[model samples]
Target: MELWMGFYLVSFLNIARCVPESSYTVHLNKLSFEKAQNYCKPGSFLTNIPNEKEMAKILKTIWDENSKTDTSFWIGLKKDKGICVEQHLTLKGFHWTVDNSTQSDFKTWKVEPPVTCAILRCGLLSVEYSHSGAKSNGFMDTTCRNEHAFICKRNIQLECPRPEILSSHDMIEPKNDPYTREIVCRSGARFNLTCSKDLVWTVAGNENVDISQLCLECNKGYRRDASGNCADVDECKESKPCEHECQNTEGSYKCLHSYNGNDINEPPQPPTTTLKNRGNSVQTQPTSPPDDVRTNETVLHIDESAGDISNIVVPAIIALLIFIVLLVIVAAIVKGCLRRRSIKLARRKAEAVALNGSSSMEKVNEKEET
Candidate 1:
């Protein structure tokens, strides 16, 4: 019971005294500085020490298993020949080996690095933990060509598992100050989280948000139905994005086009010109596409069995006949209108002549009577 109480006391004091830093993977392979940086590729890089606090944390992590004696490890620091050194501050001339190029004000050195260019340029963490209760581990400048064990690390402020993200590393925003992140749940809900150089994420507005409402979203070419389960999307019915004809598959739609009433369109393959180098001179040659890129398309072969093509000739004859019939109908209507107009003009002429003759006869009668 007393040991348990003592354990708890030690744990509390340790937690209270040390600010939490993220965990890192230690690589024990003895590699040169350049090779070490190459070994930690893509997702991680050599660890950086921003201050004494981070330096102590790294020491504690490295010497946790064997804190009895002295040891050394490679950190991400190399002297920049162009940078101006400040005598007033710690880590004065050196910067962290990150893209941000940050320098810590809390540099504690074991031995003061020489201002002269004769000494080595790389930074090394040398600890003299001769006994158990040693706290101070200071920096030293050494040659980058020497092989030493190192650790690779990256700070992950937010961790949404693989399936949750629409793509890989979607939630990881390393560029944001204080490492703030906002992730969308599969249910179209959002949660905001942030961390300050630590692994555990502190949920923003934790009291107001409910995590029980997380819903699972379907994969691509799928959507949630009324029952809250994944259903195949009918893209053809919904959007009609295809040009000629659309056939709905299990989770996708296929567009059917035509060459000459065929089912598909074959894309034209272009020849690629490649350069060949020989004896300081270069030659260009045409190359076909790789076998993986070449597609085998099925097309309905055109029939050439018959001499006369009824398919083309019949449609042409029918179109010609229709055009002639339409022309004849139009001509007949025009002739009928012309004939009616002439007849009406003749009737009017006859009426005028008859009236003139009558008038003349009446005038003659009057003269005779007189």
Candidate 2:
């Protein structure tokens, strides 16, 4: 029984080895502070050296991987000091100023002490060992430039659940198969199940079933063709189905009607005239006007001619009469003026004669008095 148990344990170990393992790796590169933060984003932890518990796990992983201890690796601790210190520490030969300075809580110092005048290097700290009662003093400092090993936590491998097999009494056996059982009904056919765990169960006699024919449903905005395939259905191709024009869209179609033409609902077209044919035979009608209408029409034409004559001749006659009347009035006024001038001259002469007579009489009376 002991030997059998040992053999069983060995077989289980071998089976476990045969199962695939799920693991991932992280690469170290010249990453900025932001990039390093992104690398540890969700599902990953930033490697820290000062945490004793976490450092122990990291050290185990590093040992298991046979990675070098001297190689430098990054850590979550950042240089939180002022920019002045950062610049001072980054400048070569200026590290002497920081040498012997008190270590900062957030900043991890290098394992190997830097030269007094050397530039300070930044990196993550890894704890090499753990001490009891107090904080672990096993922290090791590595240069930020050094490439070293790191650890990543992941979920353990899971085994797929084994499908339960039914006994003959419990199984619904297919009519054609005594060993196989029907599992699922699909398209008037039964899916058969066997004892194979890895292989998927399939229909017993449908090994050559055309899968393309099985999936004949058309996609959205498409219709099934005669060949059981999807084809684009142009809704616009249907005559006057849309108010204006139809546009095809994914899974559906749309009618586009715009108030861009005479009719918003109808598509614009060039002007056309519609004429109906009475018959194939042609007929000629009389061109002459009817007797009664012809006489009335002639009268209307004569009246129009008379109106045209009045429009031209009446204005000319009125103008000529006005000119002649104006000339006659001027002549009469000139004649009247000449006659009045003659009468005035005659009256003046008579007055002069009367004055002369009076003057002679006055002279005679004066001479007699003398």
Candidate 3:
């Protein structure tokens, strides 16, 4: 009897364990730097630093929905003020605490970063300890000025009623549609039914539906032909639907029109030119040169003098000008050398005259003294 009681208790615990107790709800919003902390529930905390496991879970949930919104939120971890600390973790996943402050013992630092005064945002995770019931962790500093939605968690325990077995004949078959059928229990029996087919059925006002008919039919842009096959509805076939070109896609069609004032079908073409192969087999004997060709030759002859200046006279004139420039440069160099020599000679003569005058003045002074 004791063994049977233990078995019943074990079964009860197993059933309870299978039921979920907590539900998480995330809030998507835009908040300012300081106001992001306010967006979370008051008792809930933000991250001072984010752990790898927590970060991975948060990223997986956000990316699973393929959201295009760009935002970051605050975490609980923060760099401690005035304390420059570097922490290293051991093999047992325990991190050595560096001295942050003499008084403060709460080691809630933005993870793996030295303590500083830069105010950073943190993410909060709610943890339920076995003995402590519920508590919030400190925040971590993530990238600044990024916006992200925050998740909130609450514990909710569900109590399911005891199940009672009923007789087979106690089931009632509701008479609704002749094609579909439903088996429902009369009050006290366990709410369970087995269907041969895997299709899901929902009860609405005593009607049994296979659920496939309630699906919406294809609209005007989509084609649902006689055999109930869906295809693209070609709008172009219907009375000049597009002003330009039209292309059909699955269930819809697009009209192609040029935005830059161009016709869709008619593109601009290059000017045509006659291809003249110098050694071609076929040749037409010209009766006379065209009037246009003769006019072109006359125009070419009128500019012959200018053409001669550009081809021959211009090159000769450039050579002559180069020779004159060379001569002028040589003359200037010779004149500069001569001017430098004259300046040097004048400086030497001035020095010598001063020295000779000083000597004569000294000799005359000595003679007068004697």
Candidate 4:
């Protein structure tokens, strides 16, 4: 049971893994703390300089020679509810330096303490004066009103931008599988599309894609044809994926069983399945149609109508059994009610007889006295 279960579980899980694309952007225009917040979209805000790594990236990429003229940039961090801590600013037991509602211990405060002024609540990245000139460099605290260039960060859905060559030549649109990123170039022409770092273009149709390569073959349960098109492997054509019957899906296959005049579409539950004591391997033997009369090796003798009949018959049998049980219960209840009514009627008749007898005796006695 466990062996068969593990097989399909692992197979499906392989394809379930995919690369989630996320990216960040930088804005060059200068804006104050309040203005920067308003300029960003609803989900995004002024860049939160959480750790040294991200701070380094911003300096390397966005803070260029042009930034030397105007050094400092506004960051997302601000004093919450006018509460400020001299040492570590902890908010409600969580560090407020991180953004996106996530917590991180990383902090890059400058050697000097932040400005003591209560109004200077906003965060800033101070630039150093190098031989060239002012350089966008490190972290500092500044007033919210201070006018400085700000950086905005947001999560974005990353996609391989369609190649310019295809658009210039008026070629058909490339079909991309979002899961595996297996791209089928237009007009059956194989275009070598390479993904950026941390992403790879896989063969696509499979449930799992190889993230390490530029472009690779389709994974198990799928294969590419002469035209380099990926399609589901037909496990049923060769033999059954299951013990009794095989049903092929888009990228995978299903096993089926027929028992008690019903078709059960579940794997690991093969009819006439015998578990061997050695290695716990499951062995299934064909029950219907004697093996001696079988001629075609590939084809199994299966009644297609049996599957249809099983679907209807199984439900009907269940309903009939339920009705029979309910009828028995109702009959027993009626019998008990009639027995109780009969006992009460007998008690009333005895009481009436005793009263009649007593009245007759009294009348006879009065007649004698008269």
Candidate 5:
């Protein structure tokens, strides 16, 4: 299949904002629905016109670009069952199609078919001009054999030039501020916008909007981050959802817990054996693993080894403290014994000196009498 790549800039102006968006080029060549699907880019396919609003947009696009003819263009819708299908798509008994750009269940058929059949399979859209030159557009079904100009659609990711967002990320103040300018945003970027007075923020041509809300909030599970950008909350980091292990996912978290090496949420139950009576004796039948040893999920339970260690460590610490106290008492007793022995030796030396001095004095007095 041949592949074609082209880029175009489309202006997206809603009630509260003006955004510059990137889009794929519409193939002006004439081809059937199957051929149009084949000629689309690698990541693209035949354009899908699912709803009235998108149908109007596609009609406007064709009228603005190709002024040569007002021929019908083939869309991605096709007849799958008794009902019309969009791009041969079905899910859970629902009829819809998601092109690279948008998804919708809206159909703008000029007249409802009395009975649907295989002959009317593919869908066709055209922009017809009235007698007063007013444009009228609608969708119709036809066979897939006919050739017509078709539109190819693919997703476009456009980054804004540069945007100046408020520090607080409050939409109310900015929507009413006079200095607010056109804020550039990337493709598919969402923002919270609020209305100042009575004007409601809705699609350009859509009238069934609730004006009482006054604010178009971002989708649930998304909030402003530190960078003032709306992003999904990382439940793992924000709330620590898991008891042991938590893995962050896009808008959710995977709670993971393991007991030893087993990661399953619940352990397998142990089998039970029954004793059968054989008239005079009872026989025990072997079963699966024992229940006491089979259950390994002990994540929230305390470890027996930890209790054993504490049981041994606390007594050891007390014994060591007692030993130190006994060693200190023994050292004090030895010091007291040595002090008493030194005092006894000093007293003996003094007594011996006094006795020796008396004997010398007696000898000297006898020598003087002679």
Candidate 6:
């Protein structure tokens, strides 16, 4: 029994590992913060600047150089009122979209927006490039109603972006396997595609040319190295997504936990996320649920959908409240102005009436004297 169990574990380890380096998509299509998050659904979420390295990588390819100037993109950070820490040069009072972790290692602020406005609690990443080709990036507060270009980040493996098919072709879908991210859906102009016993897709007539090679695609969690083999990337040295210690293993790496510093008596930071309402005395619960306990597709989808809805709905409610307040304020101002003008007009009419009456009386008196 032990031998069989050991064999199974080893086989599972042999399966391809995902590179810890996150895959990012910079969406130039402007959207509100909640809308942008919903748009990133199923595969990715809004990016939280995890570390200096990730930020550097993003700046190296931030859309284009010209658009980098005067650019602001919605990130995954938002202020939570539940957190009480209020200090200069900090993002500790906020929560990130992924994992809902409020503890941030990288919190660079250019100018902290005024702490009095609750409407400006959503996180915005202001991006720009200097004349010397240096990039300046910082986090600032903004209303969620504002439309802006945003970023989406996937911290895990990704399915291949569907290859474009220009000619008549057929696609072979994977059967029974859910984890492999190879080119299962491929269409070709000249030949049919088939997956061999070794899981390599081959074109019908061209045995020498692998269709995956033509697509320049590699399996998820791997890239083609110098020898053209799909080798697993050492993300501990490269990406370093772990908080504590990283242990590089056979096909992947593991994050060893450092059980120090945190208070054991403190409640675990999961299942319920606390959010901060800066400058306001209200502590609102954020929409992030406990981490997914299930890895099966159906269960995962249900949990993720619930969390996503929660995330969007709460912010939406807050935005609606803000809109209502603004509408009321404007309505009151217009009403006050109109009331004063009406009173002024009434006073003017009364003066005219009195003056005409006096003039008529004087004319009558002059007639009597004559």
> Which number leads on lDDT?
1
Best by TM-score: 6
Write down the TM-score for model 6: 0.39
RMSD, model 2, all Cα superposed?
27.9
C-alpha root-mean-square deviation, candidate 1 = 21.8
Q: Which pairs of residues collide in candidate 2?
A: 49-125, 49-126, 72-146, 96-116
Evaluate model 5: give its lDDT.
Answer: 0.52
Question: Per-residue alpha-carbon lDDT of model 5 for 194-238, expressed as tens digits?
Answer: 221122332222334332222234456566432334578777787
Rank candidates, lDDT, best first. Answer: 1, 6, 4, 5, 2, 3
Candidate 5 to native Cα RMSD, angstroms: 26.3
Over 205-239, each residue of candidate 4 has an lDDT whose tens digit, in order, gives: 33143332222456777765533456677888866
lDDT of 1 by residue, 210-231 (tens): 2222244568788744333467
How badly does each model clash, as a count of residue pairs?
Answer: 0, 4, 39, 2, 0, 6
TM-score of every model versus the real structure: 0.36, 0.22, 0.25, 0.34, 0.31, 0.39
- lDDT by residue (1-370, candidate 3, tens digit) is 9999999999998877765433333456655334555544342323222244544455444444344343333333333334233344211122112222132223443344433444432333322222322233333444445565555332122222221222332434333222123333332222232221112233333234332322224565764332223456666686445555666655556556453465654433433444556686454443544555321111111223444457887889999999999999999999999999779766655665577786755664564469
The segments of candidate 2 whose C-alpha lies over 4 angstroms from its true place after superposition are: 1-34, 83-121, 126-370
Worst 10 residues of 1 by lDDT: 161-170
Between candidates 3 and 6, the TM-score winner: 6
**Cα deviation of 31, candidate 1, in Å:** 1.3
Q: Name the weakest run of 10 consecutive residues (lDDT summed) in model 4.
A: 165-174
Show where candidate 4 strays beyond 4 Å. 1-22, 63-66, 89-105, 111-120, 129-137, 156-370
- C-alpha positional error of residue 119 in candidate 3 after TM-score superposition, expressed in Å: 5.7
How many residue pairs in model 4 have overlapping backbones? Answer: 2
